[model samples]
Target: MSNADEYIRKLSFNFTLSYQMPLLTIGAYQNPIAVAMPAAPLAAAAPALAPGQGDHVFGDVIGTIETALQSIFGGGAGWQTRMQKYNSTLASLWTALTALDLGHGALPPIVNRAGMAEPDEHSHMFGGYSHRFQWQLCELVATGFVAGPTGANIEVRVIGGATKAWRKGVMARFDDLIGHLVDSTALAFYITSPTVIRHAAALVRHSAISLTAAVAYTTGHNGPGKLRVNTVLAQYASLRIAFESILLRLENEGGTRAYNAVDDSWS
Candidate 1:
């Protein structure tokens, strides 16, 4: 698997373990060290408080653990930034493609200048000499034209000679459409994931912050218990919504025609 996949898997494991740990266990780690020792007389009567009081419960621990995981596996801020860059690129490409006027008309004829004297004949015509106009004819593939062995704009055909063999020209047309879609979708995937990765990081950070605050409160002499934990958990509801929003956006984008066009099974 890829590094990102492995990292995410590890993070998932961490999250699972964090939630599995009992609140009392976590509280025991730092609480006993931080909390003031009760007098001998009251010590016997005072209830033992967990590390984050009740606030660092199963769910709370999971949140903090996820954050730590993100920090370690995601290369801290770099992953987030990378995702942002890709997401922006996808958005920009989408904008450009959508705004462009694919002028509706016949496909321009291919002109031969092999024996021509005056090459200026087709110079002023549509899709003349400029590589720029040629690109418009196949912008979808144009968007994703990668370098080949000879440094030419080349595309790979999964089924060789299928383009010419197909009498209906369906295969070639589909190939062109699919190539364009794939490039566009790739751009979208790159750009959109950053938002999710960043949001996930933020969620983890928020949880950690909440846990730290809870630990502080619990270590205090007059700290409350369950009430404080509930309050902190409630604070994360909105963040959860934000995370969901990113996931939803990804789902929506994945279902788009642009995405389908670029997929391996586009035909």
Candidate 2:
């Protein structure tokens, strides 16, 4: 098949929204159900596919896979740089996703050795209910380790994009959350993900600071769960997946060359 066809096929594999779920009734129709076929069932989660947009979850890791395969077939100019980002983000995402429980969760019982009153009760997310805001901080694992902005301000807007217009002060809320999270001696997370902790630090300075033409599509997006927002979330997923697919393929093949190539970040 031609390169274009290959890329399309790769991107089309496992598409899914980043995170969202509310029993929203799609305007007035679900794409006019086919008489010849039974209607597709609705997804069991919020951030579900729009009605009739069935289960085809194209993972974002395809670019890496495609490029790695291309190198084997005599193509691919800068696959190494791509590989680092894809792999690290994939790792970072996994770490963040681990704390996936949301809603009315009891804050783990604490025995403060330092003798301090436990902060607010219940282990809940930003709003004390939905996890959508919590999902924004998926990139937190990169702090101190990643070459660019890796704090909470570096969450959803960075992961999703500036295009996603957040609720007023929403971004700042995340920034505060991250600050508290990293600083809190009471709440804690041990970096146990082999996927996240193992990778060497990366330096792709394209976060909230740089805002160059290359990654400058940081406008137009509404907040999560809003109409069309999932599309943008899926796009972010795709970009990271492109890099991860490469790293996974390389590890499987035991190809160690160019493993430490520079991955431009922050700028």
Candidate 3:
């Protein structure tokens, strides 16, 4: 073939042009090179109080008990009236401590990171015991008594509630409480019928309790009768100790429940 013929054939083939499929418009970004920004971060879904796997009763039980005992004890007959002021606070402590054992669980605090006010459950509760804890324990202790510091103040919890063991061993110790007239020197040492100090001043101090040493082996003036009150108070102290232990455990257990709830709730 001649050189001019070959050059013309190559030029004809090269004249044809390539075409692009046009930029498919991504949603609303009309420009071909729009480069869509990452969807404006989804408005962050406005944070809500999703329960976390953690303790439901957030406050301290022993701390409150310690607070109460610190305020009372050797303080006189005015003690009960004084403690009445802490009705709400003590009720909270009692509910948190007893709630778990009762299986009611506690009303966990609201955690809405969305900057909202927390919802109140007891907006209109009325009556003597204004708080939930007070109402719950009303039947348990019709006439509340001060717990004496004695013996294993925390051992009864291993077998808790209205079970046979609890009713027989722990609660039975106080079955005689109804008729006994508790005196101003509550938690004070007193003599048993056998003419000897039952929970002598020394024994209470030995048990890490430091009530005012009011009773002597000879006189035992704090109690000439109602010897059962001393026994009941000792049992009550043990029950309190047990409840305190459970409170600490529930703190962690409730948190775990909340976390598991969150995880189970999400994908």
Best by TM-score: 1
- What would the per-residue lDDT of candidate 1 be over residues 212-244, giving only the tens digit for each residue? 343343344232233433343344344333432
Question: What is candidate 2's local distance difference test score?
Answer: 0.23
Q: Cα lDDT for residue 199, model 1?
A: 13
lDDT of 2 by residue, 172-257 (tens): 33333322221111111111121121111122111111112112232332222222222333344343344334333334432111
Per-candidate TM-scores read: 0.22, 0.20, 0.20
Candidate 1, residue 5: how far the Cα is off, in Å: 23
Where is model 3 poorest over a 10-residue stretch in terms of lDDT?
A: 152-161
Query: Which lDDT tens digits does candidate 3 get at residues 1-267?
Result: 444334323322221111011111211111121222112111123222222321111122233333323222112454333333323344355545443321112422211122222221111111111222221211111111111233211100000012233223322222221112122222232222323323212111111111122122223544443343333333334444555443333232221110011111100
> What's the lDDT for all of these models?
0.24, 0.23, 0.24
Off by over 4 Å in 2: 2-83, 87-122, 125-130, 136-161, 164-170, 175-267
Clashing pairs in 1: 27-50, 27-51, 86-191, 87-191, 140-180, 182-262
**Best-to-worst TM-score order:** 1, 2, 3
Over all chains combined, what TM-score does candidate 1 have? 0.22
